[model samples]
Target: MVYVKRALPPRKDNGQRGRVFIRRAPLNRKLRPKQLLSRFTVLWVNTAGVPFSTAGFTCRASSTGGTLLATANFDNFGTAIFNTIPTPTARTLVIRTFDADDNLFRTRTVRSGISAFAIIG
Candidate 1:
């Protein structure tokens, strides 16, 4: 089970506002099970009880181990993506960026954890 909690800013005057984005989480280890992350589903939540648009944005993830994952250029909104891959072994996952310029941006390490499936269910 994966969950992301974020606090978005209030709406602005130019009809622009913040957004809550979600994508597949990436696996960190190299020896882990090979799972290719290709699709992402996104939803926008309003904390200030205001409506917003979900256009003009992109969010995605890839499981190439060392391959770079990039997101579209976001002006004012916040984007969040998640990945779920079997961790057969410990590995390092890199989260790259193409937001402004094509370059490597972020990286995270993932390791095997105790199964809490029963607790969540």
Candidate 2:
């Protein structure tokens, strides 16, 4: 009988370090609106401010059903991405905002601003 052992490089004491190992896999395909029926995120960015308005904003499909999915708020003007587990049949995009008086306003759309918007495997 023979026993074999593999040794790894010793860890460096330096506080800064790079990734030791990473699995290199092809990027996953973006989920579409129909596919989002399962659970997907809605990312949006409002340049103006909360209680959003017609000033316009952009949105993207961040991810689907997992830890990587997180919601975002518009501090100034940028990008927002996230995911969720909404009802498949209830697939829709809702944009909402408020005014100085706390007046709430929003809009809904069947199309997402993502490049792929709604594509399915």
Off-target runs (Cα >4 Å) in candidate 1 are 1-60, 67-75, 80-93, 109-121
Q: Whole-model Cα lDDT per candidate?
A: 0.36, 0.37
Residue pairs with clashing backbones, model 1? 23-81, 23-82, 24-82, 24-83, 25-82, 25-83, 28-91, 28-92, 29-91
Model 2's lDDT to the true fold? Answer: 0.37
Give, for candidate 2, the lowest lDDT window spanning 10 residues: 112-121
The digit string of per-residue lDDT tens for model 1 on 42-96 reads: 2233666332333343333344455544443322433344334332323333333
lDDT of 2 at 46: 47
In order of listing, the candidates' clash counts read: 9, 8
What is candidate 1's local distance difference test score? 0.36
Error of 2 at 119 (Å): 21
Question: For residues 2-83, could you state the per-residue lDDT of candidate 2 as single tens digits?
Answer: 8888899998777656648666656786644454334443323344433322223333322222222223333233323334
